[model samples]
Target: MSAPETIAVAMSGGVDSSAVAALLREQGHTLVGLTLQLWNQRRLAGHEGMPESVQGRCCSIDDVYDARRVAEHLGIPYYLVNQEERFENEVVKPFVSEYLAGRTPIPCTLCNNHLKFDALLITARQIGADRIATGHYARNHYDEARGRWILSRPADRSKDQTYFLFGLTQDQLAHTLFPLGEMTKPVVRQMAADAGLALAKKPDSQEICFIPGGDYSAFLAAYLEDVGEEQPDLSGELVSTAGEVLGKHAGIHTVTVGQRKGLGLTSPNPLYVLQIHPESHAVTVGSEAELMGTELYADRLNWISIAELTEPIRVEAKIRHRHEPAWATLSPAGEGLAHVVFDEPQRAITPGQSAIFFQGDEVVGGGWIVNRNS
Candidate 1:
């Protein structure tokens, strides 16, 4: 275990976060539960399919109550800080705009980077906390030989969350901790149950906390309407690699790289989404073969080890959130871009996504995915 430090745990009123606090408590770390109210409390009806108390999602009264209950049960101090304006500026607006521009953005990573880790970590420091920890199922290791903190896939490979953590800077990794990293999800649940924690039996949160019902497009539509902004004609052309027209699409936000079904297109065989040019508002479709990509370029590179990459490094690359990693040679281009040439032709390398590089179980670094080619 690392040196004993005062830890402020970010409790999301979920089993994972609750379990994290419980584990830290058992290990004798001082705990202060912290949750954020990221949206207006009144009129939550826009969020559908939530628990009775969630109203319309965002920071629901139910969530705050649950977090407070957990904190009290554990005999720890709790704080529900208001972060609505920050969330609006960083997470919500960017989500809507990305969809409008025709990309399936992963807002979880954005929230973790901007709101949860960065902003929340800053706030924790202001309160005299030594470090911030989360319930994420990824491990952070301090390698004395390398003098660095290494981000690695947890023992629970099935639940590894390194994909979303690629945005972390070296400094953040040094100060952050993940309590459930070495344990499997079932084991985590068992520990909570053994400890008689209420969250031990709680259902895992599946939908995005903010968009409960899961009609993200509708949420975006209504959100845009509230701001009195006219909806743009986000329609685009669906074509094949050879410039053959296939069908029409409502918007690029509705599709992503390697999407096979739900295209509303009927052909002789199954068709897949291969390319999305947001600039020209064109979506190229073809067979699964067309989705194969060999090269990827990324921006906003943040290296966890070696500080920077002056030459190509052999590592594993994961293009999307859930996809299995593939072997690749990663090279640092001039100024800041990292060029990833996959050993095998990967499929559906979408822009506006992330490409996380790994070395064995350790995360070397990653950045925003862009300039993909098949």
Candidate 2:
């Protein structure tokens, strides 16, 4: 008889991941529960406008305790690897910088790209595990005819996490497993209960693990203070679409494209933030109609299901996570860049967000949005 393959399960101390560990254990696979201590929840606590304490969020002390208990209950070896330095350098710093530069960034995607898959996979291999399984709702398979690995949407569409996972490379896809891809959230919770796991009813973490209260502006102020760096003065003029200076503003970092509230201007016709110019710190305000855009350019491209984009392809492009897939024509603009023109004008094509291309259920490729053309 063949020996069982050793698998390392990335346990986030949540029901989905805990259930994954249980499912793999029942199949007789040698399981090792692993959790990456990516951030210290108390690092910024007590700072002005920051929370006094945080619990039940990702990387909190409570999560670590829960993960350890689950490993003990499952009778498997477990390890909590500290990767705080890497997480801050790769995810947190860039997140702050992106926001300061008049862009909105998704740190979860950065964490998955740099830490969870890259660093954790290295740790898994060092421990003699052949593959690392995560609770992410996505799927991947090797296509024999194409001689490449393909990532696709999961069976549970509502729980699909392929948007943040678009940066996954072919090699990473080959070495990783998504055990919860075929299961819905309700079914996974039931599996956790059946396995006797205690956290079956635990609520999912919603906010960015590092940012408490979902207040980016407050976090930015606290983080800058912590680093002993003075906040850059980004205050300038608020202008209209016709280059008419309306009033003085505080800073560029406090606003984003398509922001309607907090402009501090009382206009009878209602105004929205149309653009943010970081160089001159000029914020342009206009009507809601000005926020619509037709074309966008994305760089830092990563291709999946194909080696590289050699020609223009018709695909559905999602500008943001909650955005519906829109019909678009994607073409190679330059080296490591893609140009997308939506059939219908899309609103708020924010920079620093990801643009994931899809053809049916398959992930064609994705990249970072640098700018958009009206």
Q: Candidate 2 clashing pairs?
A: none
lDDT of 2 by residue, 162-240 (tens): 9999989888999888988998999999999999999999999887888987888889999999999899998999999
Least lDDT summed over 10 consecutive residues: which range in candidate 1? 43-52
Per-model lDDT: 0.81, 0.90
Candidate that would win on TM-score: 2
Which pairs in model 1 have colliding backbones?
A: 44-56, 102-253
Candidate 1 residue 332 Cα shift, in angstroms, is: 1.2
TM-score per candidate, in order?
0.92, 0.97
Candidate 2 has an lDDT of 0.90
True-structure lDDT of candidate 1: 0.81
Candidate 1 per-residue C-alpha lDDT over 1-374 given as tens digits, one digit per residue, 9 for 90 to 100: 65667899988787788888888888888988999878664434543322234553434666677778888988999998888889989998998887777776778888877787887688789888988888899988778998888889999899999999887877788888888888888888898777677768777666676665676766676677767788787788899889988889988777777888788898998999887887888998899877788998998777785678988999999988888999999998776799999999987887778888999998999988768876
Model 1 spans > 4 angstroms off: 2-4, 40-60
RMSD of each: 2.5, 1.5
